[model samples]
Target: MPLIPMKQTVTRIRTEGNEWDGTKTEIRTPMKCAINEGTKLVRSMSGSAGVQGTTSSEAVSSAQIYFDKLADIRLTDVLEYTNELGITRRYPPLTIEIKRLNGKPILTVVSV
Candidate 1:
């Protein structure tokens, strides 16, 4: 039997905002659960009777599994208003960043 090595995993989420001026804003999220690198294995077996030479065969197999924990939101409402100058525009998309602290998400940065 052979012992397999374990691997570390990292997760990140980022949000960005765009202004009419063409400037970009960014937010970075914290690392959540470490990614899990599954496993791999190979096995083979063969049998023969009254054979002049031994026969052999080989086979390979592998397995991998992981869990994803992330928060998501969707916008369902829109409110618009026109100023005295008669300029009208729709709302911008919301941006969010998640961070981890003490093995949990503690900070949430939001921008529009």
Candidate 2:
């Protein structure tokens, strides 16, 4: 059992195609799941190039979600987050990092 309860609703299984006006397909099914949302962190990356001294920086927030042991998900999967505060947000995970914690699968996602 996990120490934290997965009460947040996770909507997965996004479709990406449509032909109505310009596209060729559309997604109609969502894989609803209950996952425990935890932790928030800011990740930043900076780069500098050449003698010209050009620089660039990128930053984004990341979050972790705990799912049942052996839960199936892919890195390319798009997830919609609906929290207890009644805020719903949808974004495709930047990168997925999975670990086994307390016998549960801990999935971490970063927003880009």
Candidate 3:
């Protein structure tokens, strides 16, 4: 079984080495992924007010990308997604997790 019936081919862009040392290297790899774009609620609580507590939530752009279990992805890596119309968007991974889906392991990445 597959978690997604359809997947898109995207480019994973990862940079290695140190910028200060002029050893920066960029690696690009093709990856099959399922991308979901939506809004994520960011919550915050303030306790500066005396005898009062304030909680706030802000809607932010978010994307969830699922990759193969063996995908070499990192938080510092950026994903380049090209739509069917040839429009491209780049997103830096904010979180990465390995989880089981449909009785198989997969890599889940969140970008904001």
Candidate 4:
């Protein structure tokens, strides 16, 4: 069992393409998930080829969605989330992790 309930809805969009005819198809599936949305500080560096460097840190929006069961979600799939106001946001999976409990798969978390 997950500590937090998976009550939010997220759509997983999978794109498949045919190499022979240059055609593509998209399959969308809605899943019950719990999303933890927040911002993380990311540090970046910039410099010229031979010049000095400048380091900066910025806060970037990050979200992690959790599922109770094994989901048919891939790293290549795009995840779409919509709010109550009808604003849709899409993101690709940056990382995917599976959690096990008592030697059984318990939860899957995808970060975007």
lDDT of 4 by residue, 73-102 (tens): 899999999966787889899999988878
**Residue 66's C-alpha lDDT in candidate 4?**
94
* Runs with alpha carbons beyond 4 Å of true place in candidate 3: 39-60, 101-104, 107-109
Clashing pairs in 3: none
Best by TM-score: 4
Off by over 4 Å in 1: 1-11, 38-70, 73-112
Candidate 4 Cα RMSD (Å): 3.7
Judge candidate 4 against the unseen true structure and give its global Cα lDDT, from 0 to 1: 0.86
Clash counts for the predictions, in order: 1, 7, 0, 0
Q: For model 3, where is the 10-residue window of minimal lDDT?
A: 103-112
Please give the distance, in angstroms, between residue 83's alpha carbon in candidate 3 and its true position after superposition: 1.3
Candidate 2's clash total is 7
Model 2 clash pairs are: 6-36, 17-25, 17-26, 18-23, 18-24, 18-25, 19-23
Per-model lDDT? 0.34, 0.53, 0.76, 0.86
Q: What lDDT tens digits, residue by residue, belong to model 2 across residues 1-112?
A: 4444545556665455555667654343443344544445444454545344324444444455555444555666667776778877666666555566687665433332
